[model samples]
Target: MKNVLIISGHPDLQNSIANKTILDEVATALPNAKIRKLDELYPNFNIDVASEQAELLNADVIVWQFPLSWYSMPALMKKWLDDVFLHGFSHGSTAKLGGKKLIVSFTTGAPAVAYQHDAVMKHTVDEFCYQFETTAILCGLDLQPIVYTNGVSYSARQTAEQIAGQKDLAKEHAKRLITAIQAA
Candidate 1:
C-alpha cells in the first residue's frame, strides 16, 4: 500500500462544517492514511520544519485539503509550506520530493456558476489550480488531477436543512478525492 499523507490545512477544522465532514469521511475510508491537522498541531503557527520534511519524505501520496480562502490556501498552511519546503529540500538539485503524487482537494464558498470566465468570479477552478501545478512542476512532484467541489460553504446563518445539504456535498467531494488517491 502507498503511504498517503493528508495535510489538513483548515485553520480550524472544529469550527468547519464542509471541511470537517470531508476529513471525517476520508479518515474512515482510508484508515491507513496519515493525516496531519495543522490547526491542532500549531495554533501558534510555529511549524516543525524537520518533522514536516520527514513526513514529506515518507509519503508517496500527498493531499492538501483546505477551504478556498482569499483565493489561496489558509495562512497557516502557507506558513508551513514556506518553512518546510526549503529551496534545497523541496526543490533544487539536492531535493528528494520528486515524483511523489500531489492531489489538491478543496471546496469553494461560492457555487460552480461563479467560477467561470464570464461568470461573477471571473475565473475557473482550474485557473486557481495553476499555482499547485506550478508548485508540483518546480518541486518535480507528480501533480494529479485536482478534486474540487463548489457551493459547500456553511455559515451559522444557514438553516439546518441547508447545512445538511452542504455536508452531503462534502461527502461526495471526499469520495471523489478518495478515488483519486486510490488511483495514485
Candidate 2:
C-alpha cells in the first residue's frame, strides 16, 4: 500500500460535516494511509518545520484537504507551507518533495456556478488553485487536478447530491494519484 499522507486544513472543522464525510470515505478506501489534521496537530499554530517537511518528503502521495478561504488555503496552513516548505527542502534542483504526487481536495462556501469565468467568483477552481499547482511543479511533484465542492451550508439533500458529484471526481483523481505514486 502507498504511504499516503492526508493533511486536512479546515479552520472550522467542527462544522465541516460534508468534507469530513468525504475524508472518512477516503480513509476507509485507503486503509493503510496516514491521515493528519493540521489544525489538530498544530493547534497553537506553532508548526514544527522539520517534522512537517520530513512528512512531506516521506509521503508517497500528499493530499491537501481544506475549505477554500479567500480563493486560497487557510491562513495557518499557508503559513505552514511558508515555514516548512523551504527553498532547499521543498523547491530546488534537488528538492525533497520531488517525484511525489500532490492532490488537492477542497470545499467552498460559494455555489459552483459562482466559480465560473463569466460569473461573480470570476475563476474556475483550477484557476483559483494555480498557486498551489505551480508550487507542486516547482517542487517537481505531479500536481493532479483538484477536486472541488461548493456550498458548505447545503441542506441534507443538496449535500448528498453535491457529494455524489464530488465523489466521482475525487475517485478518479485519487486513482491517478495512487497510480502515479505506485509507478514511481
Candidate 3:
C-alpha cells in the first residue's frame, strides 16, 4: 500500500467547510492513506521534531492542506515546516524527505476571479503559492499544482455550488496524487 500523509493546517478546525470535505473524501477513497491532523496534535505549537521527521520519512507522498491566512500559512504550519523540516532531515545531508511527492491543497478567502493580476487580490493563484511549490522542488520532491477555492466571499448558494464541484475535483486530484505515489 502507498503511504500518504495529510498535514492539515487550518487554525479553526471545526469550521473549515471546504477543507474538511476534501480531506474526508480523500480518506474515504484512499482508506490506506494516513491522516495527520497537525493542529490537533500540536495545539500548543510544540512539534516533536524527531517524531514528525519519522512520519515524513515513511510517507511516499506528503500533502499540505490548509486555508490561506493573510496570503500565507497559519503560524503553526509555518512553524511546523520550520521545526519538522530540518536541515539534515528534510533537505540536507540526511534528506529524509527526498523522493517524496508533494501536493498542496489550499483555500483562499477571496473569489477565484480576484486572484488575477488586475483583480482585487492582485496576484494569480500560482504566484501566491510559489513558496510551497519551491520548497518541494528544493527538497528533490515532485510537486503538483496547488488546488484553491475562494471561500471568503462565497455565499450559501456559491458555497453549495463549490461544494458540488469539489467532489469531482478532490477525487481527480487524489487520483493524480495516488497515481504518482504508486509510480514512485
**How do all models score by TM-score?**
0.97, 0.82, 0.83
Put down candidate 2 lDDT per residue, 1-119, tens digits, no spaces: 56888888876565566566666666766688787788788888999988888788779888888878888999878888889888888887667888888887777777778889999
lDDT of 2: 0.75
List clashing residue pairs in candidate 2. none
Candidate 1: tens digits of C-alpha lDDT, residues 1-184: 9999999999989988889999999999999999999999999999999999999999999999999887889999999989999999999999999999999999888899999999998999889888989999999999999998888765532798888888889899999999999999
Q: Which candidate leads in lDDT?
A: 1
Candidate 2: clashing residue pairs, number: 0
lDDT to native, each model: 0.92, 0.75, 0.75
- Checking candidate 1 for backbone clashes, the offending pairs are none
Winner by lDDT between candidate 3 and candidate 1: 1
Provide the lowest-lDDT 10-residue window in model 2: 175-184
lDDT of 3 at 82: 95
Please identify model 2 stretches exceeding 4 Å from their true place: 154-184
List the candidate 1 regions with Cα displacement exceeding 4 Å: none
Candidate that scores best on TM-score = 1
